[model samples]
Target: MAAFNFTPSDTSLFILMGIPGLEAAHIWISIPFFTFYIISLLGNFTVVFVVGKEQSLHKPMYLLICMLALTDIGMSTSIVPKALFIFWFNLKGITVNGCLAQMFFLYAIAIMHSAILVTMAFDRYVAICSPLRYTTILTNARIAKLGLVGLTRAVFFILPEPLFLSRLPFCANQIIPHTYCDHIVVAKMSCGDITVSRLYGLVIAVIVIGFDLTLIGLSYGLIIRAVLRISSKKANLKALKTCTAHICVMLTAYTPILFSILTHRFGQGITPHIHIILANLCFIVPPMLNPIIYGVKTKELRDKVGKCRRSSLAATDFKPA
Candidate 1:
């Protein structure tokens, strides 16, 4: 490692290119980027804060919503700040260790997001398909246990990524082609063999995200079957409506991710700028949209949000402002 041609010196740092061919438009790009960041932070935080304080929102479904909100916050915060720093200030130099830290947290939190969605799918599955036992099956204790398992699994799987990357020697270029550090991008920059890292990344992706997707599909399949058995069209619509928010969130979270993965692996002819844009979208779009989707689609949550807002407005009107 020490004798490698591209080994980092004492003042090692990786340069994060905001976007490959769109360097001149970084400031312009920051407009929407910052908007997404602010929305993600505000929306997700509101969900978590509102859910925590409202006693009525203490059930399994709401608990899962809170978990999802927290995951969105973590995912957005991990990558956005640094990305904005690069875009706004052109301060691209990130310490080798700093890059690894960002990569670990960003990827770890994303995995956690996937796991939370899977648990939420199960929550919906039980609620819709096994309504009689929904309460008994997903009690508060069980929700807490599921949350812990999701967090632990995310941490356990992603913890080794930084460690693995740290052992490999880096490029003298030290220029990452996107706004933030990615495990695959960083691994490719290494002078040492990246076959193991690549395989591990694929395995982790398949096992964690792929397996979760399979289960989510299965859960929804069972849910659809149960929904069909309802004789009343109105009742059937209502039951399916309950899942609208989660389905929207699933599409929001997974679509960009799958797009990026597919493009990266198979779309070799695609431009680098498009690839970078898609990569960033996977991180930004879901967090910014999940809370909005839930607040609008879930009637109970929307009512709570409206009540909370009215209370705040009244409190503000009574204040000395």
Candidate 2:
């Protein structure tokens, strides 16, 4: 099929269709989107806040959780708010630069999030497989360096995207049939050849996700082996229990995204509306669920979150005594 490119140029503004088949439900849709956005904000912020305020939770694991929380915030904030605007206020126009910026943060932070998970996997591996060297191997300084390296890697890979996009001639359809400024979606609108954009997008995604997931799998394989060697049922269960939350989070982070990618590539029979909905869920669901998963699964974070909740209640419910 020929490319969707029609005009030679639009007003340098791309209009986003919040949901192709559900225009009548956009108002109702905004309810859930807005709710998820607010919940994601409050939950991730609480993780950051409680982790920062408490000295006991300053270890590598919690610090890495903090990093994940920040990325969750960035990743969700990149799309949800704008999506809510489109749904509720009929605001869909995004400037070329605005779209590029959104696309950058969305992709960069998502891959950075994958890197953080890999680092967290390493944290779990060392803690379980090399308990004595956990601290020595993953000091605060080292975690910070890992974070910097992850950020740098994500940025390095994604920085070329906007340049590739900018050089395209979007002479036809400035209207993207989804909620956000996805690279492939934007590229399809351009009259200019998008081979580079398509190839780079696929390559970067595969490299980051494939590499990190492989590392995560290896780390967990070692961890499971070490845990099994303990030989005591109670101790083995306890060790495995610690990995549950990370594994849950890993699923949430990758499942929807990988599904979207596969369907986009292979599920050609899938409707565009279904594709957009799945992609939207890919962005929002993880952010909303990640902090809650951590808060519920990790006793320390759960306790601290409870304590913070109690403290806030007490402050507001105070008597003049």
Candidate 3:
């Protein structure tokens, strides 16, 4: 296939507003983004360190939490740093190959995150509904295999998106409307008809997000039924408490995504701002709030983090001169 000679457009439609230009807005935006990035990094790293350091947390639920933290870090690192550089430094230009690569990794990690969350729901379901079988079913080998399956799903499902993007003829509009090279944004830049690309996007959305959400709902539904059957009030309360963190994380991850899709599909361009905001929220908000949710809802993690902090402080105080 022949390569398309694409000329970038001058208009910045979805570019950041409320500023003189990309450079100025980027500089201001970088301040908060950089801070959030640092916090997210520390928050996730703390979870990993605490889990890894303590043998007590080697169980299935904590293992799932560790995996979630890893995915959250991967998802955030894939996009935010590059976006900040492009917007702040006035380096808006990206080659076709470069744009496709960015989109591929971003979407892949995002899908992986969703898949892992679904697996976690299953983890919780088994732990609550079949406590005796939980250990036998969710062993270390099984958890590792589930992770590999999620990674494979992410890689295979996202392959068509970048491949389809590379085939499109990007005529005069090489400039993507958003900060990063998102799938829909890049598809809109194509001069050729994007019917196939749009269809693929919808299909993948259904398979990844739709299927995952459906399974999660089923898992929770079963869990709720099991909880109701428990005659003891203390047992029911404990089960509900155990699920609170996971439920909050799931809501945070899925709600914005659904809103983004609905706003884009039905609201048209009338609410592009809402779409943009929700898209970023879909990416950043979950990672940022996940650690906090776990900390507040799960006392074990909170105590571990507190202990880690105190140990670090004590080590600092006794440093060699």
As for model 3, its CA RMSD to the true structure in angstroms is 4.3
Residue lDDT tens for model 1, 1-321: 221223345337787887989989999999999999999999998999889989999999999999999988988899888888888877777888999999889998998889899999999999988899988999999989988898899889998888888999886667789899988988988889988898988899889877999999999999999999999999999999999999999999998888888998899999999999998899999999999999989888889888899999998889574
lDDT of 3 by residue, 243-310 (tens): 89999999989888888878877887554545655676677778888988898998988998899899
Model 3 residue 302 CA deviation (Å) reads 1.7
By TM-score, highest first, what's the ranking? 2, 1, 3
What candidate 1 gets wrong by more than 4 Å, as runs, is 1-11, 319-321
Q: Which candidate number maximizes lDDT?
A: 2
All candidates in order of lDDT, best leading = 2, 1, 3
lDDT winner, 2 or 3? 2
In the predicted model 3, the residue pairs found to clash are none
Residue 94, model 1: Cα distance from true site in angstroms: 0.7
Q: What would the C-alpha RMSD of candidate 1 be, to one decimal place?
A: 3.4
Please list the residue runs of candidate 3 whose C-alpha ends up more than 4 Å from where it truly belongs after superposition. Answer: 1-24, 269-271, 319-321
Off by over 4 Å in 2: 1-9
Candidate lDDT (C-alpha), each: 0.88, 0.90, 0.79
- lDDT (0-100) at residue 136 of candidate 2? 94
Candidate 3 has a TM-score of 0.89
Candidate 1 matches the true fold with a TM-score of 0.95
State in Å the error of residue 91, model 1: 0.7
